[model samples]
Target: MSLLGATALVAVALDQWVKWLCTEHLTEGRPVKVLGGLIYLSLLRNSGAAFSFGSAHTWIFPVVTLIVIGWIAWMATRLRSIPWAVSLGLVLGGAFGNLGDRLFRSPGPFQGHVVDMISLFEPYGQHFAVFNIADSCLTVGVALAVLLELTGRQRDGSKAVKKAT
Candidate 1:
């Protein structure tokens, strides 16, 4: 199988497993300290997009996710190199993780929310928004894609320079 396909499967599995563990162990609004206030697992759910945006338009979120995943899947089949394949795989995995929740999670179908548990920062102030494994994978994948693009790693196919007569 392709690297992207394998990585995507792993990512989806890992994300789902971690989310399940967090939901089963942690209580909402309560922190399970894992480090010296630098990280913790806290169970929470978001009915909206990143950082809890669009909370009021819950239905719209899943629709958008589906569209994004469909586009990504289509793009994945066209990936021409390793970096892009890996990046797309990560995106696909993360997308599927959340998509699963939206499809079969508690509360209702197509209206289900994402479970977020990983957190970092002190409770007093400047804390990052709660996120899940899938979110992290997606963030890392996007960062990798950006780095590849910025460093010109995405253009490795052309012939080397040669002096003209």
Candidate 2:
């Protein structure tokens, strides 16, 4: 539980810190090269999911995020493996980070836009979706969770026994 809480807190702190930096220094719609064009910092405000899908139904995101947060909390109560704890922590932190934006950012509560700044390969997300640290955490956490499941690693720190076919 300690590991999970600490990881979540750290992820949220780092995510929010970077978002604050981006909001303070980056200009909207302008791309700043970060790694010789491999990556660029371009500010964008997205009210919907990846690629700005379902932007018209922005309220749904916060509701879904809250449910996810609750589910993660429930899972944490039974978590025993360090890897699972970290994975869930990252997911929870990412959800909370984005939820904060939805609840407190501009354009009113539950309709606020997420601040995205990182663009890959091309400017203004021509090559990829513009995302933030929270998105990165969510993606990595989900990937790790999938890998763990595929390997038969259980949340109780035990390996699943292969059954005879």
Candidate 3:
């Protein structure tokens, strides 16, 4: 539990710090190439989910994020594996990071836009969606969780016993 909490706090702090820096230094819609066009820092405000889907319904995101947070909290009670704890911690941190934006960022509560600044391959997200550290953490954590599950790893730090086919 200590490890999980620490990991979550660190992730949240790092995400927010990077976001603050980008918001303060980067201009919206202007790309600053950091890696010779492979990666660029381009600030954008997204009011929706991946690729700006369902942007017209900004209120739904906060509600969904709350549900996800609740679910993670419930799952925490069953966490015994260090790997699972770390993965879930990352997910929790990412969720909270984005949720903060949804609840507090500009436009209004529960209708605020999330600040995205990292662009890959091309500027202005021409190659992909502009994302943040929180998004990266969510993707990596979910992928790790999926990999663990597929390998029959249990949250209780035990290998699942397979029955004879």
Q: Give lDDT tens digits, candidate 3, residues 1-165.
A: 666677778888999999999999988867899878899998899999878999999999899989998998888888899999899889989988999999999999999999998989987787789899999888988999999999999998999989999
- Candidate 1 on 1-165: residue-level lDDT in tens? 287888889999999989878878777777787778788777878787777888777778678778988887777666667887788788778888888887788677787889988778854224677888888888888888787776666423233354599
Model 2 regions more than 4 Å off: none
Query: C-alpha displacement of 103 in model 3, angstroms?
Result: 0.5
Runs of candidate 1 exceeding 4 Å displacement: 123-126, 155-165
Candidate 3 positional error at 141, Å? 0.7
TM-score of each: 0.86, 0.98, 0.97
lDDT of 1 at 106: 67
Better of 2 and 3 by TM-score: 2
Best-fitting candidate, scored by TM-score: 2
Model 3's alpha-carbon lDDT is 0.90
> What is the lDDT ranking, best to worst?
2, 3, 1
- Report the candidate with higher TM-score, 1 versus 3: 3
RMSD of 1: 3.4
Per-residue lDDT of 51 in model 3 = 89
